[model samples]
Target chain A: MDYVLLIEQLLNGFQLGIILFLMAAGLTLVFGIMDLVNLAHGSLFMIGAFVGGTLTLVTDSLVLGAVLMVPAMFAIGVLVETIALRTLYRRSHLDQVLATFGLILFFNEATRLIWGPEGLAVPLPDFLEGTVALGAGITYPLYRVVIIVIGLLVALGLYLLVARTRFGMLVRAGASNREMAGALGVNIPVLFSLVFGIGAVLAGLAGLIITPITQAAIGMGEDVLILAFVVIVIGGIGSVRGAFVAALLTGIIDTMGRSFLDVVLLLFLPPNAAESAGPALSSMLIYILMAGILFFRPQGLFPPRGATAAP
Target chain B: MKSQLTPAHAVSALLIALCAAVPYLASALDEPFYVIVFARIMIWAIAAISLNLIMGFGGMISFGHAVYLGIGGYAVGILAFHDITSAWIQLPAAIGLCALVALVFGVICLRTRGIYFIMITLALAQMVFFLSVSAERYGSDDGLNILWRSDFGSGIVDLEDGAVMYYTIFAVLMGCLFLQWRMVVSRFGMVLRASQSNETRVQAVGIPTYRYRLAAFVIAGVMCGLAGFLQANLERFVSPDMMNWHRSGELILMTVLGGTATLFGPLVGAVVFLLLSEMLSTITIHWHLLFGPFLILVVLFARGGVMGLLGSRTTRD
Candidate 1:
C-alpha cells in the first residue's frame, strides 16, 4: 500500500511489458506480412534461451552469448521458412496451424531431449547483478532496468526500420499488398525469408535477455506465446509501435495486479478469501483487459492499413 | 429417397458394428483392458467431434475447446460432491453450462476472424484455467476425486459396472456420429459449410453467417460437455489439467490427423492418437521425443490425413 512499493511494482510491470512487446513484434509482423499464423514463434524464443544459456555457460559472457544468438536464430528462422513454412504459405490457415503446431511439439521435445527437462539458470553478469536504489528506500534489479533500456532501444530501432528505411517500406508494401509487391519485382520470396529471419532473431533476442531473470526451460515459450498473442491483439496486428505500447500496458497491468491485487481485495473480502482470490484474479487481469479492448475496437488499438478480415 | 444404402455407407456401418462388437468380444475373452482402452478412445472421440464441429464445419479455429471438457468434468465432480449423482440432473446441467459459456464467449470472439480469433479464444481459456486453479473450494490445482460414478436404477442400468459403462459410451458415440452426419447434410449444415469455404460470398448472399457460426459453436460446446461428463465418470476424477491448452491442442491434432470434415474423422483421430500414445509410452519414457517428429512428418507429407488419403486412393482406382 505504500507509495514506494507501488512504484517498484509499477517498474516491474513496465519491464514485463517491454519483454512482451519484443515477443509480439515478430509475431505481428509474420501474421501481417506473410498472412501466416506461425505457432512456432514461441519455439524460436525457447531455442534462443536454450542456445544463449548454453553459450553463456561456455563463454561466461552475456554479451557474447547474445551476439552469437542473433545469427544462430536468424539461420534457424531462414531454414525453417525455406524448408517447412514456404509450402504452407499457399495452404489454408488450418494447415498452417497444424504444421506450425507440429514445429512447436518438435522444438519442445527436442529441447527437452537435448537440455533435459530441468531448467537452466542464466546467471547475471557482475555489473548487472545487484539491485539499484530508487528513491524512498526502494530498490529494483539492475538487470531488469537494463532489459527495459534494451527493449526500448529495440522498439525505437524497429520503428525506424519499418517507417524510415527502404526495407521497411518494402515490408509495409508486402504486408498491405503482397501480390502488388511481387508484381513490382520486390523479390517476395527472398523478402519473406528475410522478414522471417528478422522476426526469429528478435524473438531469440528477447529470450536471451530475459534468461537471466527467468531460468530457461523447455515449454517456457508456451506461456510467453500466449502473452505475445495477447500483446499483438491488443496493440493491433502488424504495428510495432502498437505492440510497444500494448506490451508496456499489459506488463504493468499484469505485474501490478499480481503484486497488489491481494492487498486491494482485502478491503472488500476477508483475509483468507482475499489471499485465495488474488492470484486467480491477477492471472485473469490481462485477459480481461484484452477482452475489454476487443469489445470496443474489434480490430485492436492500432490496426495496420489494408488489413482485410482474417480467415 | 431410396431405402438401400450406398456401398461406402454400408462399409462404414459395418466398420462401426465391428468396433462395437470388439469390446464385448474382448471382455468375454478375459481382456478387459482392451475394452477399457476402447472406452477411453470413445470418450476422447466425443471431444474431438466437438472440436471438428467448430474447426472443420464452421470455419472457427478455437484453440481452447478443452475448456468445455473441463467444465463438463467439473460439473459432474461438483454435483457428485454435493450428493447429486443422478444422470437426470448432472447431464443436463453439464451441457447447459458449457453451452451458456460458449454462447457468451462466442458472441464476443466470433466477431473477429483468423489469428486474432485463435489468440483470443486461447487467452480466455487460460483465464478460465487460472480461475479453476485459484478456487480453493474445488481442490484448486490438485484437482478433485469422485467418490462414485453417476448412478442409475439397479438391474436395468448400473454405471458402476465397467461393461455397462463401456456400452453406454459406445452407444453415445454412435448417436453423436449419426447426429453429426444428419446435421452436415441438412440445410443449416450447408450454410455452415458455405461460410467456411467463402464467408464473403455467404455474407453477400444475405446470410448473417456469424449467427450460424455462433450456433455451431454452442452445439460443439454442448457435445464436448457430454464427453467431459463421461470422462469424469470413467476416470473417477476431475482436474484443471483436463482443460489445459495442451489438451486443446491435442483435440485439434486429433481432428486434423483423422481427416477433418469427414463424418468419422474425429473418431478415427481420437482412436489413433490414444493408441499411439499408449503404444509409445509403453516403449519408452521419452515417447514425445519420437512422437514430436512423427507429427511433423504427418503435417509435411500427409496433408489429407488418414481418411483423406484412403478416400483419394479409392477414387483414383
Candidate 2:
C-alpha cells in the first residue's frame, strides 16, 4: 500500500507493456499481410534469446551481441520461411496449426538439447547496471528504462515502415486483398517471405533486449506468445496501431493487477483468504479484459482494412 | 439379413470381440500392466471421441477441450477433499461444471471463427489453468490426489478394482461411440456437417447454421466433460496441466491423427498416441523431439489421418 511502491509497480507494468508491443507488433503484421497463422512465431523469439544469450556470453559485450544477433536472426527468419513456412501459405489453417504446434515441440526439445534444461542469464552492461533516482529516495533499474526506450524506437520505426515505405503499401494492399495484390504483380510469395522474416527479426529483437532481465530458457516464449495473441485479439488482428495501444494497456493492467490486487482484495475479505484468492484472480485479469473487449467490439478496437468480419 | 454382414463389418465385429476378450486374456497372463494400459487407452479414447464431436462433425475446432477434462478431474478431487466419495454426486457435478464453462465460453467464442476462435478458446483455458495454478486451497499447481475411487457396494460393482474400472471404461466408450454414431446420422448432424462444408451455401439454403454450430459446441463440451470426469477417477488425480494448451493440441492431434470426420477416429488416434508415447519414452527421454516431427509429417503427408489413409485413397477425394 505504499504510494511510491505502487508508482514503481505501474512503471514496471509500462515496461512490460512496451516489451509485449515489440512481440505483438510483428505477429499482427505477419497475420495481417500474409494471412498466415504462424505458431512458430514463438520459436523465433526463443531462438533470438538463445542466439543473443550465446553471443553475449562469447563476446562479453552486450552491445556487440545485440548488433550481431539482429541480422543473424533475420537470416534465420528468412531461411525458416523459405524452407518450411512458404509452402504452408496456400494450405488451410488446420494444417498451419498442426505444423506450427509441431515446430513448438521441435524448438523446445532442440533448445533443451543445446542449452540444457537450466536457464541462462545475460550480464547487464556496467554502464546500464545502476538504478535511476525517481525522487523521494525511490529508484528503478536503468536497464529497464533503456528497454522501454529501445522498444519505443522500434515501435516508431515499425510505424514508419508500415506507413511510409513502398513495401509498406504493398503489405497493406496484400493484407486487404491477397489475390488482387498478386494480380497487380506484387511478387506475393517473396513478399510473404519478406514480411515473415521481418516479423521474425522483430520478435528476435524483443527476445534479445528482454534477455538481460529474464533468463534465456526453453519455453520462455510460450507465455509471451499467448499474451501477444491476447493483445492482437483486443487490438484487432492485422492492425499495428491497435497492437501498440493494446499491448501497452495489457502490460500495465496485468502488472498492476498482479502487484496490487492482493492488497485491494484484503479490503473485502480476510487477509489470509484475500492473499490466496488475489493472485489467482489477478492472473486472469487480462484474459477477462480480452473477453470483455471482444464482447463489446468483436472485430477489436481497430479493425484492419479489408479484414473479414468475425462470425 | 445374416449375409448383410460385409467383410468390413465382420472385421469390425472381430475387433470388438478381441477387445472384449482383452481383460480375460490379461488376467490369464497375469499381466495387470497390459490391462491398465488398455484401460488408460479406453479412457483417453472416450475423451478424444468427445473432442471429435465438435472438431469433426460440429466444425467448431475448439483448442481447449481438455479444460473439461480438468474440470471433471477437479470435481472429483475437490469432492474427495471435502470427503464426499460418492460417484453419483461427483459425476453429475463434473459434467455440470464442464457444461457451465462450455456454455459461457461457447457463448463468447462462437461469436468468432477461424483464428479468433482458436485463440479465444486457448486463452479461456489458460485462464482456467492459471486459476488452478494459483489456487492454494486446491494444492495449487502441483494438483490434488484422490484418496479412493467411488464405490457402489458388494452386490453390484467396485470401481476400486482395476479390472472393474477397465470394464466400466470400455462400456462407457462403447456407449459414447453408439451415441456419436446416432448423433452424426441424425438431422442435426446433417446441418452441422453442411455448415462445415459450406457456410455460405448453408446460409443461402435458409438455415441459421450458427445456432446449430453452437449447439454442437455445447454438446461436444459436455461430452468432453464426461470424459474428464472418467479420466479423473481413472488417474485418481487432477492438475492444471490436464487443461493446458499442450493437452488441447494433443486432443486435436488424436482426432486428426486417427482420421477426423470418422466415428472412431479419435479412439484410434488416442490409442496410437498413447502407445507411441509409451514406446518413445522407453526409447528416449526427449520423445517429443520425435513426436513433433511426426505431427508435421501427418499434417504434410497424411492429411486425412490414419483412418483416412486406410479408408480413402486421397485427402481431397
lDDT of 2 by residue, B1-317 (tens): 12233343444445456567788988899976877787777777888888888778766778878888888889888998999988888888887898889889988998888888888998899999899998888998899999888655464567888767878888888998898888887888888877887889999999999888877777777887877777777888889998988999888888898878777677778878988999999999898899888888888888778766665321112
What TM-scores do the predictions have?
0.94, 0.95
| Model 1 TM-score relative to the real fold | 0.94
Q: Residue by residue across A46-138, what tens digits does model 1's lDDT show?
A: 999999889899999999999888899999999999987998887777778777887887788788889988978999889888988866788
Q: Clash pairs of candidate 2? A: none
Could you give candidate 2's per-residue lDDT for residues A183-287 as a string of tens digits? 989998888878888888889888888888887889989889989999999999899999999999999999999998999999999998889888999999999
Tell me chain A's TM-score in each of the predictions. Answer: 0.96, 0.96
User: Top model by TM-score, which number?
Assistant: 2
**Candidate-wise lDDT, in order:** 0.86, 0.84
Error of 2 at A82 (Å): 1.6
Score candidate 1 by DockQ.
0.63
Collision pairs in model 1? none
